[model samples]
Target: MSKSVDRKMSRGPSTEDIIEDTLPSTTETTVDKIEEISSLEKKLVRKIDLRLIPWLAILYLMLSLDRNNIGNARLGGLEKDLHLEGNDYYTALTIFFAGYVIFHIPSNLVVKRLRPSFWIAFTMVMWGICSLCQAFTHNAAGLIACRFFLGTFETGVGPSIPLVLSFWYQRDELALRVAIYFGSSTCAGAFAGAIAYGVLATMDGAHGIAGWRWIFIVEAIPTIILGLLSLVIMPDLPSSPNKRWLTPEERELAIQRTEMSGNTDKQFFDKKQFVAALTDLKNWLAVGIYVGLNVALGSYAVFLPTIIRDMGFASLDAQLLSIPPYVAACCLVFLISWNSDRTMERGFHIMGVSSLGALGYIFLLASESVGLRYTGAILVACGIYPIIPLTLSWVSNNQLGHTKRAVAIALVSMIAQVFAIVGTQVYRTEDGPRFIRGHAVCLAFISLSGISACVLRILLKRENTRRNQTYGPADVKDLSTLEDIDTLYDNHPQFRYAL
Candidate 1:
């Protein structure tokens, strides 16, 4: 008996072991059969990216070109031609924001009420007309009128993009998509330089038109054409019936992917969320971050060529040198946003970059080295540009409902545009070359931005930690119903801020 038992044990369970090995366990089959939903999301995201990003990027490129061309036009002797004296030039720059700031909230709400494609495209054509009008201006008052209307129509595109992207992309995916189109604004800077050089150099006297006027005409036509093209290309929100491009299955997946991230409300307008957006502390904090960025951004856009010209370069060389900083900005904007998305982090990236912007101003204020000051200019662009998208996406990320997100995005934009108003005023005609006051003001605000970002991050992290412990870390499945989801908003114990 002992010999038989020893032989059986030595054979390692004999036939039973072989039989069990031949058949997979329940766990193994489940593991093998389990579907990867994220792969489908990637496919859908790629599809959305293809259909959306390119056209939007082109539109933004033109929008930015049209918006920032005034600065480039200044180099082409726009002020002298228009007889803009004293603060008149700054007033023209500042008035655009008046319309821009006033219309932001209304336009965002209007976007919700109208089909996004129709609304956005309509604005594009209108703004192009306004931009075209700038070419016909004979005085500062005429230019200011064109600029104000340009800002009014242009508002429907620039600040509204993040809100539109939010409807399609999840928080995890929002930043990069925001960067791509927004980054084109930086590309617009590069293009602005290159185009200004081209228009001023060759078209100075063409068709009996001044080169500055030529700049407006050349940039405005493409905008109108692209606007018409967008009707055929621009997509509506996934839930919108206008989304003919999406199949039923893919569309559902698109909606589902976004739903997994947060509230995917069916309503185009939510009064409650609108009220919440107005009242939310986060929106105001986001405004602070943006105020800082806009001050730097506004000054940088309108004054760079002048600053470079004051640095002893010829006007054309100054235009050419402006191209490099914008080129660097284009690269850094994409990389920073890519990394922000990759890590699912917003604040530290914002804080770090704002500090980098402040340091750039430091370089400007601290040293008179042409090389150092120029490098400071580059650093400022590299630093300031990335934060715009990051902060917009951050506000959009935290807001739970469509209306809230939309309203919050606009509110933050509306308030922040005021600083851009200040930005135009910062680099006064007298403050050429060093522009110590302008540089110092930028340094202070940008530094405030970095600090604000740090504090916001710490506060968000603490809230997230508290929720994780108390509510036990909610996931997509936690709030089982739409009612449950809508009511909770940010207060939902499971909702975590994208820190």
Candidate 2:
């Protein structure tokens, strides 16, 4: 009987043997363990988002300083020294935007295919050179020419940084990061004034250059050096050798998560898709909001220093005064953005803050008191600056796929600049020493932004409901690969549009 049983065992598998054979293969188990480990690693890595946030914020701080310091210089007699008259100063501002508008989309497209280190750094270096040239401008034409080139090179910044962040963080995490980076403009506004203060007070004619010239030359130096350092330090994408922050396992998880979320390498810019995005009423709504908001921005960027200087202060003192408002603005921007991220809400926060700007402009227009006007200016600075970052983030969060987002970003920015052309012309010297018309125009536009934000919220909610009833997409999770995250645009049909 034992021999017979042994023969049967050898001829056919027992239940125990079958169960053993059904267990995972060694290779399969190992792969499973690797995947589990990889996932754990990714969760660990994403926790340190703070580290990257500051660097990006600082980069933008410098960008804002470079871009708007001209206002400070204007207060320090740049107009007088350069012999700018009538509308030359405004012309220079407009020329800068012209170049900025022309090159924006191209810069973004190039950055998509190239390493940010080279393109961003190269842009920084070029803009720095242009900034340094401002110290030597002998007339309005030279300043305008330099401003034009400066705009051309600096165009890489406003769009590329947010796009770059999208490569590292997911959508829900982006608003605050965008705010943090955008908040640096507040730092630029706050600090540039102070720096201009010291430079003007101590070195008005240092090295045979005017104080305004010194401001331009001194500010450009640090930016150029930082641009070079960024080349070595800024992490490339996951496939890059410099990507030490994310382990290979983590990278695979990143890739896997993105793919599972429907962020595949599909071309997002089908002609039909482009037409759909373009004709979408929501995109146009965003355009109108951004345009109005940017008009406020353009006016502030060109006139903040002048307004401060007009407030019973010297050129240096005006620069010093400019700091506090920006500092306040930065803090508020961060607070709002953090709350937005925490709550997974955007439209309300954006609209609420933008309305604050309208109030600021109204107060400034109505009051003759310096203190009241100054308070209003602070509110204006805070309110106006946050909108662009918030708007960009909103668009980015709402859009799905890369090409569509890229196009959307480019479209919003270019159109905003088109409005900026109009806004830049608002604060003519003829209207200054109290720009009543400019203040009124700014208030009107800020009101426009508020209305648009509310309208957009309604539109998004409806769209989200429609999508929920249809495809039932997932929610936004991955920050870096936002372009591929499908759930953000509301794949689910029922619970859509959390505005």
Candidate 3:
């Protein structure tokens, strides 16, 4: 019997032994678990997109319309009605951004402490009240007061959305999500023109009010309504009990996935993180790029109607014509951003788009043809609008901690708005019809943006290569266990930047 057993063992054991040998190893099991978690994460992302994106888009759309309706109001007799002479109209426009720039960092910090849902809603209500007051303003001072207060309340909404999005999305997923949110502002431009045309054409003297007054009153209603609705709709942080939309399991997954993606630290307001962000060279490069693009953006947003009117279109025709450039812009922004997310490249996309805008400005400066000028406006819109979200997401992508990201985004945006004061001042009354000086300044800025983007890309790529060479072959999977380690957030050995 012993000889028979020995013979069977020599024949490679029994069938059960072979079967056991074929089972997956520990590494394979881990890989399978990772794949399963990834699948679950994708599903979670889809659910989040459905619930969050559309409402945020609508909220931004309303906010954008309120902020920009002043441009449309300018076309609808706001200047003449309020007796805004010389630089008073421009002063009103400029002062809004003054308040806008001052409050951005503070507002972002407030969102970090309070629930974003409540804070955003509260600010929305305040801005809506301010917008409604614009309809009642009878003079330049009254309009400027309403504009300044309107900007103060609006500062929270713009920066807070990107900060909130960073909490939910990975860096790779952020560009398109931000594009959708920021792109809504472009849609609002188109909608603003259409709405302005309708109100000015139909409601010119309705109820003893001018068409421009009706624009302020009518636009404010939806903003106030949406503001109230946002209190119930906006999701809080993943760790908060106020996140009623997510299950306990989903919340755990949210936190784990975010941490695993290298957004490891979660302190509320770290001064160290703030100092780190302030010291980073990349943040300032990003700000320089944004300042260039936002100069064009601020100018286009506030002066499209006036520009179109100078092309010999009637007030009604100019308002209607303004719609097309913005519509084209909306489409281009979505296209570029979608490609940006897919290619996972930001610097080239920003540079190339800004170059396109610079070309458009050249067209405006060199030609007197109405058709050529209109085409220039379309190209400019397409180029400038997409850069807003891309540049913002770029800052968010490079920053490591929540507090760092908040400060970086707010600081860069605030700096850009400071330059936007220059933008508002460029299109002076003395330079109408052609606005040659304004076009020249915008072109210079856009060209500067393209150059900065190139330098930034090269610098980031070199840093990534240096890190890889120094670290050799580190395991990215080990990043999830970083809570046990004492490394600073985003400075982990295996944390690679998205170049």
Q: Tell me, what's the RMSD of every candidate?
A: 9.8, 11.1, 9.6
Better of 2 and 3 by lDDT: 3
Q: Candidates' lDDT values, in order?
A: 0.83, 0.72, 0.82
Predicted model with the maximum lDDT: 1
Candidate 3 C-alpha lDDT tens digits along 1-499? 2323212211211223222333355656565565555566667788789888898999999989998899999888898999988889989989999889999998988896888889999999999999999999999999999999999999769988898888787666788899998889989998999999999999999989999999999999999999999889887777678566776767777775565444566566879888888888888889889899888888889888989899889988998899988888888888888887766678989998998999899989999999999999999998899898889888887776778889999999999989988888889767989999999999988887888888898887676666667975344442456553324655666555555
TM-score of each: 0.92, 0.86, 0.91
Q: How close is candidate 2 to the true structure, as a TM-score?
A: 0.86
Model 1, 3-119: lDDT tens digits are 233122111112222223333676664422333334444667789999999988999999999988999999898989999987888888999999899999888878867878889
**Weakest 10 consecutive residues of candidate 1 by summed lDDT:** 6-15
Pick by lDDT: 1 or 2, better one: 1
lDDT of 2 at 94: 87
Provide the lDDT at 372 for model 3.
98
What TM-score should be assigned to candidate 1?
0.92
Candidate 3 lDDT score at position 55: 88
